[model samples]
Target: MSWPHVIPYANPIYFLWLAVALLPMIFMLLIKGKRWGWYQSLITLIFLYISFGGKYWQQGLALIGYVIFQTLLVWCYHHYRQQKNASGIFYLAVALAILPLTLVKVIPFVDGGAAAIFGFLGISYLTFKSVQMIMEMRDGTIKEYHPLRYIQFLLFFPTISSGPIDRYRRFEKDLLEPPTREVYAGLLNRGIWSIFLGFFYKFILGYYFGQVWLPLLNKSLMHQGFFSWSLILYMYCYSMYLFFDFAGYSLFAVGVSNLMGYDTPKNFNKPFISDNIKEFWNRWHMTLSFWFRDFIYMRLMFTLIKKKVFKSRIVASNVGYFALFMIMGVWHGLTWYYLLYGFYHASLICLTDAWLRFKKKHKKQLPSNKFTKALAIFLTFQAVCFSFLIFSGVLDQLFFHH
Candidate 1:
């Protein structure tokens, strides 16, 4: 079968097709206060085919295998948890859920920098969802599993490629309960506005910053030394480009979900305005940060505390931060810069935590007015941008590769 393949929301043209495809569902939700499941499924398949079809068919096959693997894993775990729960089994289930993604991440490092056969875009996000399900199942929070609904949640095309990473329970709730007409109207309005904002961010600003000026800055920096003005400019420019590109994509995902009457979580919230590293993480990539906090950091802290591994809560928390960021860095890739990027953030967060504790102890003596807040924000922004410079892998290209 002949078909046009496009990455989700990669360009303006895709949005046109998206709008056309969504109109019928939009009407149905508005008029009936319910979704036409079969129709939604058909459109989802079409879009998935468009994204994973054509030259990307290998990734398509990989995705199918991944979905089946996760589905079966979760199913088995759910049944087992229902009968009886064991710590060993829960840990095994979580590990098995993450195994494919781990292989996909590790293979490139050992295989002469070749991509894994099983790797596909958004593998990390899907694995997160799968692992979350298994964990919740262990906790007895998720009592039942509907195979079809679970599949639909995984294949939800709007946020499939990259995500705001909707929670299973939240997504299931939306799936089961369509919004009322008044609420749907507000959602539609917000969705349209978000789409327009996404266009401005991704197409207009992102194109200028990333496609146009970034290369120019890089070319200039290449001829000059490391500490040149062009490099500094490139840092800020690249940071802006990264924010707009990722945030724009997130807005599109969220906007599309809203249009369909599902309230997926928001990803960004004035991240640049944050006064500290902790606040920045809270604002930027909100879903991912919260996921790491809930699934990794909190769990690790609990284990350490429960086992009496550390006497001090502060020390335990700091260790947890390091472990969490290191895993996150490795998740990004098994690369030097990515690893450094994770460590960099971990260090910043630890220092910020220390400062906050000190401030709390001496609240009366320490300044807490507008000037201090502005300075904190400025410092935090610069530190974050510097970390992004590392995350960009430009330093690796400049120093190591060259």
Candidate 2:
């Protein structure tokens, strides 16, 4: 069979190759307390080729162009920031950074549902990093931009395709400061365990849910109708599949990053057990949500508050949630389901905030107990599952197509 290496961490063979290539690097970290940069660079190129080479050569070219474009954009923005941090210039730089991603996201709808030529697998994540650097540069958090280190941070292969999306400052710190052997030993242990756990989650559990159960439930929905028991079953099953598949992938990404001496932030954190929608955001796809929080929601709220756009802070906060989720939804895709998914989550969070405020005002009147907490978890779980169903896009297919 041909190599199923087009996708990262999805195929067993890809991990096999990765493990072999990482052997020397792992040993070096364990023994010498330093990474061989040349060797690291070599493996990165090889893996990037494996992911973007041959049948995907167009993607490879696109990635190279994209990287160069972002590197230059960042460099220019850095230089501009040094001279003067014009809000207008900062906004323009941010816009330019995300322009490629915007085209990639919007092209399908505009171009008879065709993928953009410049779109690569990890384009969104890369754009996030680029925009982050620009933002930080505006804030003077990241004062300097070294093109090579920027490229290394942007293209770090382990978390490349789908990320735990490392921050440039955090990544650069690890790159500049190699871990001690003792520290690396712990990281190595965690890394290996995470990989094996990922295998179980993705190959076994994710396979069963996504490959077997999801397909069967989907077929059942087609025959049994949208309001049937099957749909309910499908919702929960699809949620499980999504969690295992994505969380498993995140585990693998984080695991591999640990091996390479970077403390990549985790994407998932027992999200299923979150007590409320706000708590869920904290626990789920954490990197992405946190990125949105820091870069999008926080910034927008700051702007609104600073400008006194809304009469009340509560009103401003609610408006911020809607804008944040709508933007996030649009980022996900131009589809109705994706938009609804974002809207639904934003609504949930806002309502949760209202409840929290009311509960706080009531103080001793509203009971705080195990039963209340469990009930909240249960209700929040159902709300989140429904949101995931919207995200699954099966409703659009089931209702619109059939």
lDDT of each: 0.91, 0.91
Tens-place lDDT digits, model 1, residues 273-315: 9999999999999999999999999999999999999999999
Model 2 pairs whose backbones collide:
none
Name model 2 segments beyond 4 Å from true: 1-5, 112-116
Q: How close to the true structure is residue 380 of candidate 2, measured as C-alpha lDDT?
A: 89
Count clashing residue pairs in model 1. 0
Residue 331 error for model 2, in Å?
0.9
TM-score of each: 0.98, 0.98
- Put down candidate 2 lDDT per residue, 1-402, tens digits, no spaces: 554446898677898898899999998998898999999999999999999988888889899999999999998988878888789999999999999998898787778435547798999999999999999998889988899999999999988888887889999999889899999999988888888888888889999999999999999899988879999999999999999999899999999988988788888889878889999999999999999999999999999999999989999999999999999999989899989999999999899999999989998998999999899899989999999999999999888997
The TM-score, computed over Cα atoms with residue i paired to residue i, of candidate 1 is 0.98
lDDT for model 2, on a 0 to 1 scale? 0.91
| Regions of candidate 1 where Cα sits further than 4 Å from its true position | 112-116
